[model samples]
Target: MKRITTLAGTLAFALTVGFTPVTLIQAQNKGRTEISVKELPKISSNSILGSFNADFSGHNVSSDFLINHLGEWLGTGSDHTYKLLKQNKDELGIKHSVYDHYYKGVKVMDDMILLHEKNGKLTYVNGEIITDINLSPNQQPTSQRIRSIIISDLKPQGKLTISNIEEVITKVSNGRKAVLYHASKVEALSMKPLKAFTYYIDNASGTVVKKNSRMHDADTPSTSTTYYKGDQSITVDSYNGEFRLKDNARNIHTMNGTNLDVDTINGGIINVEEYISPVANYTAVDTKPAVEVHWGMKNAYDYYMTRHNRNSYDGNGAKIDNYYNFDFGGFTGGANAAALDTPLYGGIVCMLYGNGTLFGGLLTLMNPVVGIDVAGHEYSHLIIGRNGLGGLNYESESGAINESIADMLGTAIEFYSGSSPNWTIGEGIPTASFLNPSPSPYMRSMSDPNNVNPGPQPDTYNGTYWASTANPDADNDHGGVHTNSGVGNYWFYLLSQGGSGTNDIGNPFNVTGITIEKAEKIIYRALTNYMTPNTTYMDAYNFTKQAVTDLYGASGNEQQQNVKAWYAVGIGNGILATSEAVRNQDHFNIYPNPVKEGVLTIENDKNNVSVEMYDASGRLIKGAQKLNKGTNKIYINNVQKGIYLLKVTSEGSGISTKKIIVE
Candidate 1:
């Protein structure tokens, strides 16, 4: 699975705004003045923001105009000001402008909105905004009692170090409620510094409002190989007519890592030997594994830059320094790779690839250097860390999501860097590890996560082999960050490559694959734009559905597939795209959308259905019709020109609903 035309020129939230279920709120008719069907704004909405498809044939407005008229649009108070955060333009020429909510000159952390534009017209506005912040930051300091109580509670065994403490307001209940809290990070000094947490102490009640993980670690199994990838080319620094395993172009350094303390290797500067050769040809036996890591990192970098347009993992071309032959003792075994902060040694953040003990030389013991996926996976963890894909600690469901995302991206990069039909993570590692020794023993399988070689993972959420989220970190692979990852890993596979099976819920399902090219973009967008820390599997459903709607369109194939794929993974019910009376499909087609003659044709594939039409203000129109199993045409007489919602209820159950222009 090694084919490089590019590295070697291979293939190339809210006021507080934590994740919550996205609720659909129908526009409640407050001021009901009927407008013509031709005059109705082409609209869309989530619980927070709305979308408008406008034609700037005559007039155009700039992003500055949107920022200036923020209050007029979202009904924010005069005390609120929107500070421009950043603007980005994709290859499709769509411009995205982000603005954060500022109340009385203070930034409300997660409360921000994103505007999508094409040419000049605003296409969509999203993200929650915080308003009516009555509590001033200068109001009061946290009481001593509360601080003492918090410190006592946190430091049970070790010294509790509280840092990065500040006051901020966060909103919940869909941004309808707000609370002020003294937010600070607390870590037990005597414990592994790896586990640090951020706490939001309620300023009023002094209760621990929330605790989130600040530790983002790529501590898991994934590997690449010089053993499998065969001979390859890598960029080496040319110095004194010698070549060193230091890629100046990509800013990557690969160290020998012969004998380093695994405990303190994560941090501190070290003067280690870089794998080098007197001449350009490095055929030394010792340099082979180092070549694997150096080559893998460059490819992973190219994969992100080439596909997603990210310059590097941090999107700022962050230098990547790595150490091969890293020794992860304590049964973690061979092939353990992690994005650890190398201390005085490199004084830079480095990804450590373990030099595993070759168990009988026929199997590699544990994690690291399993192949391109390891590099891609660890690199993805860095991206997830930067993007907050998995919040708080890298454990439980959040951690599972974090790992799953890495697996997906890793597999994608594996497919990208080379050619492979087997979408398995560590498949390229030549010698099968003992943990899951088989004909092809890879770490994780996106195509079939249930492949019980390395570990039996869940394909559907809460399905067979589902890891207990409540399990302690010391026990269950950090609450099955590696196990429960199968749900999302399988979801990505089904989303990309189409599959049919009954989920654990016993719901038989079938989804049309949107292909990896499109599917990857959807995942990328949802993870980067919509998802927040602490987003659940169900919350991911909403975010991804919105992502599908944003990238493609509502009621389209991508949306349908996205929902069904998640459903197959046991997240939400699969949605069927219904007719709009003017809805276009192969079996159904009605001429111009706003039924000109007021005659609406209904198609009932399910049980007998009832149709109800509502105006923009949620006011039901005068007419309601009952249609049979076949197609029925009904004449509309009382309906006037306005945007109406056509609710199709099948038998006694409601399938789905949307708005339409009924003339």
Candidate 2:
């Protein structure tokens, strides 16, 4: 760490010396910033969930609280600090102070924390940061290098124009923990597959850092000018005697995407035009797709709320805004659909659906604006983004897992809200650009991932046709995010429907499908509770098994099936998660506090534990039972509706007595 007495002094020296493009005042001028990493609450050695419960209370606590409590962990004199990026207040009135990590006064790539607050107390947080950095102040991108990047990456005459560019500390994986300065730019490409690209260039070496496609898509499989659902009732808001395609009750609004930049193409633009019709029914031949988008989002919202107990994507009933028929480089639509948070704005999220891309004046790629499952898929991205499982860059194995999750959840929604003959993504939007396997006109297959046409869809981890993340870029679909997702997609399928097959690694296994209801619950629980931003396919295997242990007994049939499914998908035989291998043995979690449900889940890593339930009057309602090692489920159906105390004891791990309600 540099020996600087004040932040102002450091900035003045750096500026006067003409070294480093860091402006300390610029970060402070941003709204409510600087709650960054110093030290996160510690976890036990055998912990399953890398989470902590801190004792702190405040309504609008400043960063000083962190600096005071966490010592140097909150910067103080460290080389790294955090900048407030997004401020989100959900319907439940919980404030999610989203912060991005900055080191030496510049933003680091993919390092952020979502500090959650509710009822004047810090509740939860999830995010990660790279620690190893070696770039010096003088090594920052020079003005000449910036101009060179502009000329080489995007020429002034080129169609792709830069939206925003900045120097970022990119972590390089492999032998050691290190970082390199990269010029990151978000640019919109004009022709072919018209859309935006976020590419990075090594500032010193002048090599490409990597290009990631920021396509957080949620879409439907409807055909051109044809509604997939075929005439469904929709809600509309009326103002000035004109009916608009805005569902005030659900807070959903649809917009037309025409003559717009990459930012405007992806909704969240407050002043953008909303779809309006003079009549209550929006049946105009040209503007009918808006109807489908509105309806699809409604179902997506209702499904998450009703099925998962999540209020909306963020568990706070955030409004859903969507845009369809986005104009891309003179094309009516691009070739993708995405869930996006505007880079320039905080807490503003939107969905974008594009049509076929143009090929030499002919639109060749096709993406329909309506499909319930596709909409659910897109909504799943928003859900992932909010639930601490967000910030998974759409690249490498993390990106693959992220994509696969949406596929499974979206398919689950398809079963919940409508009918589906098959588990094919975008089955309604057949396109020549992306050729599906013969006789199947769709985007992807959860059931038979290997049967995809014209592309690699590996049902086993890193088996065949898997995209390598060695040097991820856009051409390889960001380390085969779409292609490698087949592995997880198959895992979910086998978990849903019983299957028997030999994996690519020559491992033969048979899995008993837990059914979609149970499987979806496990997926949701693992994702929201256990997953972090950079979770790998291998990590998913353990987390999901832990989710199973939480739902069922620690070693129930579901656990066995989970093992078999992963084996069948080439994720190895599975891990036992013994005390020796796992960490954070001190912490445990209990869920569904109201006890309205029949069962309550307890997650811990201690051994020789015991649980007891007592009534409000101190009378023992349930006798003490010897708890298992991993997870335990206690049934409350026998207990009467009243307030009760639940006590759990573990040798050397301490005892916990919590007040639980049974209804």
Candidate 3:
């Protein structure tokens, strides 16, 4: 991996020269501005919830206390109340309570708050908070009116299930707005119930203001033996002197199934007894597949917790449920697929896996349940959906982004598990012989997407078969989500491995390897905090650069490397060219050296460059440089009266010097 020095050295250089660099000050200011979003804040008993005040004691309480006291504590009378949306204990055993805010018996849309309690003391609080509102007579529409509107909208498909009508305050970017609405949720049961869809109807206008689907589809291929923690471990819950497949440590549940005989109404097998267990207590030998699934879940949980301090996929420790031996069409459906069901219960996502077809019905492939990468990939879908900052839309480029993220996290998790062939998805899983007589070993290869035996997807954005959603093709995997995702998949590989190669569009470039650790952090932060629902490849390019900027600063080499990485992936074309001018030793010049309007313009004929300004006493004063070619402008409004030296550098050009006067 390429190692680069951090900006601490620049700070030291500034101190030796007698001036604190403006770059450092700017970072401090930026930190202050983003603190509220990046860190959890303590919540007091008097913390306001809507117009009402939170009334629970701040410390030493049980889960029951939170459940029973929320309504009274928040000063919500019978008319206005709080309902528990979800609750779970984090890895640290801290209980997190998530609630939906309601006013005068109407459900608020997307208005949720969370309280994190450690050892019975409220340690932190987050989520949407509404402060401005008029508790006036905002009468909500009647349930009959809401049901009529919702039923009409959901006609011919979804069946309305439960409905909540409430009046509540919502936050706008500028301030807050109090509104009355009925939140109606619906689900349609065909062979099985599809994900529930929710709609918020404005009581006054009787128009649908917003809509949400509570379902999240989370997938896979593979047969090879891999080791995790010497031997695979499963978390079992004790019930009535019998043990069941449940991992309370990571809040995951496992179930066994026979030919997907799920009771759609109950959401699983007719009886929980179908859940598998070893004949003897606490044994991994009997339930090998279940043990593998449990181990993968633990590794994924560890990856999120140890790497990002996230408790689980939701960042709040929500439970994850999985069912194995889930053959959809009896034994025939085995080996063809594994799936994370879209249905969500109390904010939890469930996964279903099938055994391979009996008598080699699937050719060479085996059951996908045991592949660590497959488990990670399926779990990531739920994480991406539950992401609060913004979720990638489930169609087109957004959907491709969603798939690529899952693939990336899946691969990363596999690597974390000390698995071999980390660059290949389902590396240990056996492949099929559908396309050839020989059985391949991988479902997808990150380093070489085209190498997948059965079918190869485009690795470059403009590769010959690159799928685009512009012209719809329903038969094409929902606008080629699995296919086009190779673009991102390969990009991550290049970012991790540091190679010179042609991108999907046949653009040639070299990237400095940044190791998987740094690479995952950049990708995770961008996907979680910055990338919005409809984020495209171009948007990911921009957000990833911003993520690097946040972690390594604007002027550091990390940002430069980030630009190069994206360019290697066939994006950020101009960014690298601009930086190249300075490195190529092009004629670098700065005009109007004597500051009058506090602005300085720089021009480089051949390459993009960066600049640092130092005082006459050799103290670094400013360095937030992105020296693009042709009329690069910077403001030195606070330079003060002094003689200063400006240093310019780039990848091709070694270093150049210029002097400026602050008038």
Candidate 4:
């Protein structure tokens, strides 16, 4: 499913280019390339821009050279130009520069140009450029007018304090209709450091076209005994004459939530009702559940800082803003649920907890804040939200990666804190189930991710389901991000515990188990250094494998185990890393090109060929093991008529995939 951020002022846009002059040139191997603003590729994958030797007469060039002559090179008028976004030298000694495309002094969303140079020679060029845009400025709303529109429409809760506001140009789409918009960029009101929203208001129509949440920070003092921590010294913050639950040592703050108003655009702590102060200082210790929450938040923070050397979720000394006792109606029921806004809520990263209870027939109730793994999991989500970590798109493969990584890291944090049964998330939550609640209710398990508290989780690639094709939307966990996340979760478990077992597709394999410490470091490096916003499962596998190689030798047991773990989870590309020689494309063959009755035959040089089939959507259909050498028949009689892939594997032949059709 395509997970869209739908807010009063959220934007989803694709560029629409117009006519412009350009010159096309042919490169040695690259196709004919055009140097036109409107003609440039929007994404980086297609940014080869022909060959370096063929273009520019094999001369080295700099970003400054392109900057000075870009207008003439693209034949754009004076109304548009490129502005340097940032420049940095990578770890490999390559200079990288990013530029934002501006039209008539307003920034265009996603119109970026990236230049990578090695030793003063241009090695890469990629960007989204648009030329000849007609900027007919209408008598649109001014900055104040746009701000007013946002304020009036949003009806934000609590006191409104606009942090920053600016102007920009963006393409806005109301449903299928798209238009150019002059917009006012407004930051959400800050209740704390990392709790606010960023908004883009269309000045032309006074409508919000785009927005994202700013969100994430904490202090400590010694206090009395607590229910959760059990008579231990707790941290508290004292200022002037008031005592609050903010922890100065760990930089954690606990806010009390009383009036859980939901109708407001920014679901904020209601201030008008004297609804719980910004910081809580309990009148009595027993009356405060925030105490337990404060303890859990501190544990999560320390987990990352001590284990990963991460200062905070953003790797900066930002305090954590945590709120408890959220009584928000409808969805506020704490039963088996907790929420950390994936996107910032007006720029705040706070965890909301519900006081779950036994209803007429409700099976389980939960206080999510008390669970260390749950706390760690929610906080990990904030860490992944940072600029790196592939941005782990909240849809499809990337989305599942996002969920699984969070689960794995959250599990890591729990283990770091000495929690038992480290593989289980929300293990601390008491069994609030109406029937047979003795075992205690848990959210999920890493060891057996296929079986979850709530259904729909697919533990292996073969069991995977896409939100785009299945049930899309937040209700369906954004295309089964949580469900398919089981694949990665199981991989982590296997990597942590070395064993051989039958995979979801019924393939038996053994994987070397690596310590969780090593696995975590590799995953962390991959997320921060090697990953991009649109990374896929294959990309993640490759990235993690490379990470393991970077830390350990390429041919070491660690690397092999990493590859095997990925393969065990149904990511077969790991075999390519194990041995490059076995991946020859012309080694095997399959016959009956398009099977008439869904029966396919494979002819191979070796016996014991393993086979697996998948539908057009990349979902696993069926599999077989130990096929004979010369000729083997695989029946897909029940397989529907459509395009499919048949992947054959052998111990000696590696893996070969062929596309098939059932007529």
lDDT of each structure? 0.59, 0.61, 0.55, 0.56
* Residue-wise C-alpha lDDT for candidate 1, range 135-195, written one tens digit per residue: 5443323456445755655543433434435665543221222333423323222121122
Which of candidates 1 and 4 is the stronger one according to lDDT?
1
The TM-score of candidate 1 is 0.65
- Candidate of highest lDDT: 2
- Cα lDDT of model 3 by residue, 1-663, tens digit: 011222221011111101111111001112222112112122322112121112122122343433333332222334434456667764445465666555554454444455556446443343333322234444566778776775665542433444355453332111122232333333222222232454555544666644444433321011212232234444566655556667677787766655433353545435433344433233444356665676677778888888878888778897777776555442235553344433422232566655555443544345354577878887787788766544665555667888888888888888887756378776545544443455457777788888876657677676756776643232455567777788788878877877787665767888887888778888887776445555667767766765564454433566666777778767767263221211111355454434566887675665556889888788899974877767677888887987777787777657665556667
RMSD of each: 12.8, 12.0, 15.6, 13.9
lDDT of model 1, residue 510: 93
Local accuracy of candidate 2 as per-residue lDDT tens digits, 238-297: 757777777776778788765434344553354357676776776667666667777777
> Model 4, 198-248: lDDT tens per residue?
576766667766554332110334544333434334577766555677777
Q: How many residue pairs clash in each candidate?
A: 33, 22, 27, 33
What shift in Å separates residue 78 of candidate 3 from its native position after superposition? 35
Deviating ranges (above 4 Å) for candidate 3: 1-230, 237-243, 259-286, 329-332, 336-348, 358-366, 428-430, 433-436, 471-474, 574-596, 599-663
